[model samples]
Target: MQQLRISIPKPCTQNWADLSPAEKGRYCSSCQKEVIDFRGWTADELQDWFANSNGRVCGRLSQKQLDYFKPKEVRHEGWSFSAKVLLASSLALLTSSKVYSNTFAKSDSAIHQNTNEKGSKIKEEAKPSDSLIIIKGIITAKEDKLPLPDVSIFLKNSSVSGSTGDNGRFTLQVKATPGQKLLLEFKCLGYATKELEITPESVAQELELEMAFSDEGLTMGAVVVSYRRYPLHKRIWNFIKSPFVKHR
Candidate 1:
């Protein structure tokens, strides 16, 4: 029986793992014994070789070798323009979910209490006169100049309260006795709360409250709120537009 022989190409010292079992017993011509040559080059080595040769030489695998090991072309479903747009939009929405969710959570907690004071104060002497307090304000967003709806208003220790309608307007009536202090709490979904202290003088006149949102809430979406009070001229302008506003 004749012994099998294998040939080693010049300037190539690496062994290929994808060889047939019979070819594994190849001998190097430079060294006269049956030996397996193994000095496998990595992708980096190939790139370096090409770079050093100015794209002239291949380190271990030639273009022919590469072609031999090249992968077959795979058929894939083509994506339409709309599909691509939808995919990109979905990815954007997913990435922004955390931002939106955090804003919502903070807004929800904005009107909440930090600590509790369980009991109410007893009526004190030297009480001042009791007067009707009228409070009104526009609830505006902080970012995009949009209106917030369904804002709740609470007057501490009193049954007087109200809410902002769809256009972010609210009105409330409150009464105060001399030497008495009152706390007002304002709340809205996805917005920060507003708290105000009321005195007897403020009770007889109309008062405007400005609400500011938490910093985190302002980052997620369009916030279009102005501070509760507008300038005198601005109020007049708004009033002129009131007829149009009322029709809506």
Candidate 2:
């Protein structure tokens, strides 16, 4: 199957949080369309969905996925509209560059230990398994190398999450194989968000994750998303409105 490479030269300004949830995606009452959230989708899944899609798609994606596609940006010196990447017979003209931090947005976080229903910390014995990945580490500030406390670390799509204690130490565990790679996010208030790729083999040694102090505010990588596939009419509409897109 051909690879799917999507680009969005124009970023949408509408806040997606207000949109109501639906079966497939969230409905944007303003644009009268459903915005699919493809935050944790695999590259093969993405390629399959785009291959079969028949209508216009407006969805969201991760910065990692963008890097994998490696969409090149070009400027037309005398054009009034912007340019975007278009797949041959499979155009994905969307506001894909609108940043959505999915990796750090995994919010079911608990610090140092697991808690029960009554909020009591649960201490369970961790047995090393071939299918388990334990990421134990100390989080620090990138500039001063001082250990940072209250840092939330979690897997991008999984429920496995943990935070650091006052000593800036944490142990996060997840279930995956040595071959499967997963995204890990480090997040803390007043610090720049950070991410890492972890595998069972790589988790053998302890980690020392670092984050930048948020001078202005917490910052994350831009994540482009699309809702659905676009048919010919929508493409024409986009062309008429922007009039600056170039495709192959």
lDDT of 2 by residue, 1-248 (tens): 12346654454556554567665546777767777766535676876677567756666555565566654343343322323223422343233322333433443343223345335422333324437567788998676576777788878988889999878899977787557888989887556789998778888899888887554421122223343434444456767876875421
lDDT of 1 by residue, 72-154 (tens): 34334344754786899999999899788879877666535322222122244334567665767676655434555677889
In candidate 2, residue 206 scores what lDDT?
93
The collision pairs in model 1 are: 128-178, 140-225, 141-225, 143-223, 144-223, 144-224, 145-223, 145-224, 146-224, 210-228
Among the numbered candidates, top TM-score falls to 2
Highest lDDT: give the candidate number: 2
Location of the lowest summed lDDT over 10 successive residues in candidate 2: 216-225
After aligning candidate 1 to the native by TM-score, how far in Å is the CA of 25 from where it should be?
72
lDDT of the structure predicted as candidate 1: 0.49
All candidates: CA RMSD in angstroms? 32.8, 21.5
